[model samples]
Every structure is written in structure tokens, then in C-alpha cells.
Target: MAEFLGYENFLVAADGAVRTVRPEHLRVLPGLGEHDGEPGSCDGLTLEGVVVDVAFRGVDRVVTVDADDATGTTVRLTADVRDSALTASPGDRILLRADAAHVVALAG
Candidate 1:
């Protein structure tokens, strides 16, 4: 079985020794916000990326992004945002924010 550790920004897995933050824990917003290149005052984990895909699902909008991680490697992520809240299209740059409170630990 895998052991897990939960933290404010991410989750730690025992055997794999990896940290992860799920899509549900992230918020996709248009990069045009006041905090363009940086995290907003209330953000816990912030990431800037280019929109790779966007799909409408009823009241939600599913967005996929290709963001550079701390090591400059591209990381692909998907998140669901309110349809009305996302104004970005494919090829647009956007911001992803995850609040500490929403972060959780999961078994690998």
C-alpha cells in the first residue's frame, strides 16, 4: 500500500516519492487578471501556462494547459472552471491557482 502526506500546496506519495496537485484543486483563470505574471494575494499555488485545449461541458469549461515547471519542463494539466469565468481560448496564456485549503493527499 502507498502512504501519503498532505500539505498546503501538494501531496506526497510514499513509494513513488512524488508530489501531486489534482485538477479539482486548481482554478483556471484568464491571464489578464491584475496578477498577471504572479500569484494573486489569495493564491496558494500559482502556475502560468498556454491553453492547449478548451471544452465546454454544460456549466463548466474544461481547460488543458501546457505549463513549465520549476525545472522548465512542460507539464500538462487539466482543470474545470465555470463556463462563464473562462474567457481564454486555445493558444492563449492563462493562470492556474490552487488554494491551500482545497489541496489533498491521494494514494499513488
Candidate 2:
């Protein structure tokens, strides 16, 4: 996961760096959603990627994301199938954002 987020800015601590990002801090945005390269101060943590695949977990949808930043790392996240206006799929460009508070760093 750190490999996939090599391009992203993360908070560092004396113990270690953040490896996993909590889902609560992450927000999945539609491709058509408006935004700049990075999430603004008001906005949450954001990541851009392509949908490598999608799976159904009962009523939820698990999305496999390949970071568009070109790190070659793929992340799997879940969301309610009935999110906002749009949903994600394979080959679709998508965005994921998380608040700094919700994103955490762990010592391994």
C-alpha cells in the first residue's frame, strides 16, 4: 500500500509512516467530479485511479483501484452499491479521498 501511495503526501512520525488508510476518511468521487490534482483544505484526502475490477459483497461493491499516478499498486476498497449519482467499474477513472484525521500512519 505504501508503494501505491509513494506519490501521495503523508504525515511522518518518530515511530513510522502511515501504511493503511481507513475507509471512513476516504471518499470515492466520480470521474466527472470537479477537483484539482489534490484535495483542497476543505476537501478530504483524494486519490485518482482506474478501476481494475469490481466485486459484489452482498449489497456492497468492492472496487479494485489501480492508482493513476502510475505506482502500479492496486488498492481494494468498499462502498455501498447505492452511493451518489454515479458508480465505478473496470476501466473507469475514479477518485478516492480521505481526511487527514481519518487517514492514519502505523509503525510496523
Candidate 3:
């Protein structure tokens, strides 16, 4: 069984391809905040990408996206819904923004 690592509060799903967790889970390491001269500010860093995969775990929906940046990174975002209709699907283009605390994807 795959060992679930520590939970990430923020993420973005890419391309709807399940099992590909590559670039989605990358996070800025601690002590690299804006006060320390990081390029992007600690809060409100933005990324644009194409939706790759979408998954559901209990009440939270996980999405994976292939980013269109130099890093070519993939991201995952989580959404909690009162009902299942809120779930995202494959082939969706999305924009995501996040602060130091959490990542928020703007549904397109």
C-alpha cells in the first residue's frame, strides 16, 4: 500500500490523469518566505495549467493540473463540497492562486 504522507492543505489537479503526483505536491520550503527574498510573494503566487486528473476522497475532491510554466510542474487542488455536483472533470483549464497557507484554484 502507498503510505500517505503528511496532508497538504492546498493543491491543483492536472489533466485528469490519476496516479501522477509529480509536480503537484511541490511547496515552498519553510524560511523561504518573502521576507527572506523569495521571488514570488509568500501569499498569492499564481499558476496556470491544464487539468489532468480528478479524484475524490471522502468529502474532498482532489484535482491535478499540468502547469504551463518553465518548471512544467503539475499541481493538485482540493475542494470540499456539500454535494457531489461540485466535482471537477478531465480536460479543464484552470488557474490557481495561493497564499503561504493554502492554494486556491480559479475554476474556468
Candidate 4:
């Protein structure tokens, strides 16, 4: 079982259904405001979404995803070496860390 440490109260079922496991769920992370700081750091939050686009560079990979949250924010993810080669396509469900900073997509 992969435990989302920072999001102990936020759980998503295997069928993509989201539910609040606890009443204080939303208060787990309080520093993720839109303008509080930079993006890309998952220190205080976790995000789940579907991959909307993907591009690969020499040894780097970039992914564009639309989060399932109400903000409807589009986030770009930089893949680690292993993740960079994973077979990801549009609409593939994924779980990512919030506060992601560098949202740059790789050039095709």
C-alpha cells in the first residue's frame, strides 16, 4: 500500500473515486495557496490527475496534466530518469506532488 504521507486524510479509490477519510482532511496542508510561493515542491501537498500531454527530450521527459481539484490548474511535470521512459499517454491517470515548480514541457 502506497501511503501518501502528506495527504493522510485524502484518499482516492482504485476506481478514481475521491473521498474524505477524515474531517480535517483539507487542513493537512495549509501552505499551498495560489500565491504563497513557488510551484513543484511537494512539501505540503499531493495531487492526483490525468496526463493530458507528454514530450521527451534527450534524456528528459515532460508531462502536462490536469488536476482533478476544483482549481482546474494545468501542471507540468519533469520526469526522473526512470519515469522519463514510462509509457504515458493522454488520459492516463497519475498521482503527483503538488507545489511543482518547473512546469516546462519538453520540445518534441
Candidate 5:
């Protein structure tokens, strides 16, 4: 079942619960593995997946990532990134990291 842990930082279960995370909260990085000294490390959450789509939205590019959650269920996450900061293309494997403090669990 999906778990809820109030507002702010919360555990997202595999049971399908609405998450209140902003696209800006997601940080995209090249390659995989634990990002220890890297900014926005996995100390919060780390998602590895292939870039499915990239859409230009003004100065920011919306990157769509297809990844699996903790339960192994495929999930789609979008991250808003600046054009100068984006270096990913379709089929490129990337990592998405977000501080738990920016994640919120809503009752479903």
C-alpha cells in the first residue's frame, strides 16, 4: 500500500499515491551510481532511467524520464532544467535526484 507521511519530506510507497513534488525539485545528472560529493545526492532519492523525451519550454527544458520506483513499477518523472544545463538526449541514461525535504506524500 502507498504510505503517507504528511507534508514536506515523506516516503513514497509503491501502492500509487499522489506525490507533490515540483519539477524544479528534480536534479538531472549524467551517468549512474551513488553521487556522494555531487550536489543533490541520493541522500534523498535517486532515480535511474532513460530519457524518453525532451521539450523546450522557454529557457528551461522539460526532460521526461522513464524509471521504476522502489516497487519496480515504471514511473514517469519530469524535471525542469535550463537549456545550458541540459546535456541529455532520447535514449540516454540519466539520473534524477531530489532531496527528500522537497518530496511530499498525499493520501490516495
Candidate 6:
């Protein structure tokens, strides 16, 4: 993941320019594991959602999650079935995880 994070300390100049405070480093991960966060890194993204449906894709199943934070805010994402216990059905709780997700800044 470090390989993906090119900048060490991202900063913006008064003129609206981005810069890094340090040098660059390269790293890699073999695979993304379940439960635990990213390998050798603590960064992970988890969101709560309700399983809307699941479709079988060969040996694995693609689960569709519908997330609503009330206030009319909603988001959706797809995930692979974690285990046999997770079945394709509506109203199931979904813990959408992005073990490889990284934080990025957006102009407000």
C-alpha cells in the first residue's frame, strides 16, 4: 500500500499546490484477509448496510448492500460473500469492508 501512497506529508501551498514532505517508498501485499485490517497496515474502511440481494457468481456470491444513514442519506456497494453463513436474502446486516481503501482529500 505504501507504494500507492506516493506522498509522505501532503500539503497545499497558498497558491493551491500539493507537495509531499518526505520521499517515496514501495511496498506490496499478497492478498486481502478477512476480519483483520490490511496486512502490515491498520488502515481499513467499514460501513454498515442492509443486504438487499446476493447473486451467485460461480463459486462466490456477489452481495449487494444498501446503506442508509437516515436523514435521507444513502450509499451502496457490492461485496463478495464472506462465508457460508452469509446467504443471499434481504434485510441481512452487511459490514462492507475495504481493506485496501485510502483517505483522500476533496475540495469542499
Task: Judge candidate 6 at residue 40 and give its lDDT.
Answer: 34
Every candidate's lDDT: 0.66, 0.55, 0.43, 0.42, 0.74, 0.45
Model 3 per-residue lDDT tens digits across residues 1-108: 222553443333443322222223333221212234544534544555555776667665566555543344444433332345534457755554444333334344
24-100 per-residue lDDT for model 6 (tens digits): 11121112244354453345334456767777777766666665432335645455553665544767664554432
19-106 per-residue lDDT for model 2 (tens digits): 4554334556767467555445253345677777777766556566655222434445543344534567788888776665655556
What is the RMSD, in Å, between candidate 5 and the native fold over all Cα?
5.5
Clashing pairs in 6: none
TM-score of 4: 0.39
In the range 1-108, model 4's lDDT, one tens digit per residue, is: 213432233333333444332212211121224433445454534665667776665665555555544344343333332343366677777655433232222222
Model 1 segments beyond 4 Å from truth?
Answer: 1-17, 36-43, 104-108
The sequence of per-residue lDDT tens digits that candidate 5 reaches over residues 27-71 is: 888777646578655456777889999999888998888887777
Best by TM-score: 5
lDDT of 5 at 18: 50
Best by lDDT: 5
Candidate 4: segments with Cα more than 4 A from true spot: 1-43, 69-85, 98-108
Off by over 4 Å in 6: 1-42, 68-72, 101-108
Model 5: worst 10 consecutive residues (lDDT sum): 1-10
Kindly provide the TM-score of model 3 when superposed on the true structure, using C-alpha atoms: 0.42
- Per-model TM values vs. the true structure: 0.67, 0.58, 0.42, 0.39, 0.76, 0.46
Cα lDDT for residue 15, model 3? 39
Show how many residue pairs clash in every candidate, following the order shown: 0, 5, 23, 7, 0, 0
Q: Model 5, residue 41: what's the lDDT?
A: 54
